[model samples]
Target: MRRVFMIGGAITKFGKHTERNLKSLAAEAISGALADADVAKEALQGVWVGNAAQGVLTGQESVRGQVVLRALGIGGIPVVNVENACASSATALYGAGALVALGEMDVALVVGMEKMYLDDRTRVLSAFSGCMDVEALPELTRNFANQQERVKKGMQRGGAKKKKSRERSIFMDFYASLALEHMEKYKSTQRQLAVIASKNHYHSTMNPLAQYQNSLTIEEVLEAPEVVWPFTTPMCSPIGDGAAAMVICSDEYARRIGARHSVEVAACMIASGEDRSKITESTLSRLAKKAYERAGVGPEDIDLAELHDATAFGELYSTEELGFCPLGEGGVFAEAGHSTLGGKLPINVSGGLESQGHPIGATGVRQLVELYWHLTGRAGRRQVQGAKVGLAQNNGGSIEGAEGALSVTILKA
Candidate 1:
């Protein structure tokens, strides 16, 4: 099979773009990617777009790619729209890689975009439809009410109750429960998790496209207002608008296309939770092992990484499961500075979804943009010296146990 290579990639600064519509953001990213690849628009054979919440955010449906591409005067070529929740863009790049490897296309443009700050916060959040079973939603809401009732009783013993906004961000409750359970089992503290958020904030200071570019000390991060029990507001991924894109093609095709830099795609892993327990710890275990086998490289071989951190605990548990740190050791690994700049293996130098803003559909592709810069020594202040390989872990869904959708990609310079 032909090896797929990323010729170039780009991402727009992630932030709230209440004024800009979805297509404008998409065009900005695609135009930048095309210029980076040094390829004419007509040379592209196909396009793949990743979007998670356009339907709820913009009332747009399957026509996302068509409309977005049309804004750039590049349309009529085959366009594919991908929606895998937060893994949307990862699947987009993986699909582009597959097409190039299978000889289906000589060149492909993969774009991931989301304009999440469009509707009111409450309305836009309803896009989390994948996390629930529609058939039992009525009962699930009832269960939630009952669960809250139980929580109220438990809190009453301490004269406490949940705020209305607390109930608004119900998914945080799920994530908080996971974090609480992990802490109970591991003796992890809020300070340890705050380090992950703090490090990413500092890392973003070097990232021009990052939303949170200001530096923050661990003390400042830990002192921020708590979003949940252990999570502060700054410890969570921001909601914003942005686009990320990469031009990928076969190695021979890349040389023919004459792009400046090229990175090989060694392994791409996609896993579904078909037969698993809720919060199963097996996704990372099984997927990372398979990825290592396919790429012939282990976690220790990675120079840097970009893992999902929709919340602080994401990095905490995911790093452990990916074997970068032993079980219950991710907090220690993070607080030790191993996951920060100048560390053994830096993670989320694009500031991650936490600081870069989680434009769900655009996030996975942005991870590649971060890796592209790192492997090519273009990450500026966030660059890891002597870096030769990079990895990204993008997961989504909140059913049963842990994250439901898992996608892992390993890249080599």
Candidate 2:
């Protein structure tokens, strides 16, 4: 396989776009990326578009990629549409990278976009339910109830009262349950979770494209309204609309085109959660090991990361799963400033999904865009000092006890 390099990357400001449609947002990101790469539109050999809920939310289904690209006067090329919940765009990047690595295409364009801001807030929020197995929701709910009961018992025994949130999403509940388990098993504290949230909030202040630019202190994050126990509203990712795109090409093509400052794709691994009784290894852990091996680097070699922080717990949980720290020590790691800027490994310097806004399909690509800037020394205030290697983990959809899809990408300067 040929070596693949990310020649360019771009992202739209992540927030509610009342007037922009999916195609328009995608066009802006694509144009920016093409310009950044100094590549002409005609040079793109293939296109991959990642979008999760356009059909359910906007009534646009098959041929979504073709329709979107046609508006930009690009056609007759293979336009692949990818949908894997939040990891949609990252999956697209993996697909495009594969094509370049296989020499099937010297240059490819990958774009992830989503228009989630609708007038009907109910409809907009309800769409998240699609990420789960609707048919098995009843059983899932039963399991969740059991878990909640256990949590309540644990909290009571620990001389604490369980708190609940009015916001509805099985995902929040799932994360809360996981947080409770972490707290129980590892003695992690909610205050430590607050530290993570506050760190990301401050990081977003340096990211112009982030949805939330305001900084928050640890006290403020802890005082924020609860979305779920151990998770304040500030700790959770908000609904938003955005688009991100990247231009990837084979090393030969990049060198031929004189593309400077391109980041090499050291590794890109995609995997699904496995089914097993008393599973010992998590999907993220398994994939991270494969990614590290493929990249010829260890977690300690990574200078920065963009994790799938749908919530504060997501970052903490992923830190351990990605081998950045010992299992159950994620909270301690965060509290010790290990995950902060200027620390050992700065994760989510773009503010992460929690502060940058989670635009579903666009999130995965957005993470890559942030890392691209960091590796290239473009990240201004949030830049990690001398970042030479970066990793991104994007997971999407949830089923019983597992993520439906996950992608891990490692890049080197």
| Best candidate, lDDT | 2
Clashing pairs in 1: 278-400, 278-401, 279-401, 279-402
Candidates in order, TM-scores: namely: 0.92, 0.96
Q: For candidate 2, lDDT tens digit of each residue in 106-134?
A: 99999999999887877776778788888
Local distance difference test values of all predictions, in order:
0.83, 0.89
- lDDT (C-alpha) at residue 157 in model 2: 33
Candidate 1 per-residue lDDT, tens place, 1-413, comes to: 89889888889989988788887898888989989889888888999999998887667897999997887888768898998888898998888889889998889999999988744767666776545454655665565556546644554223334232232355565667778778779988778988999998888888888888988888888667666666777788877889999988898998875779888888988877554555455777888989888888999999999999988888888899899988999999998999988899898887887898898889889998889888988888778998998999998776654566789999999
Q: What does the lDDT read for residue 281 in candidate 1?
A: 56
Question: Model 2: which residue pairs collide?
Answer: none
- Candidate 1 CA-lDDT value: 0.83
The root-mean-square deviation over C-alpha atoms between each candidate and the true structure, in angstroms, is 2.8, 2.0
Error of 2 at 364 (Å): 1.0
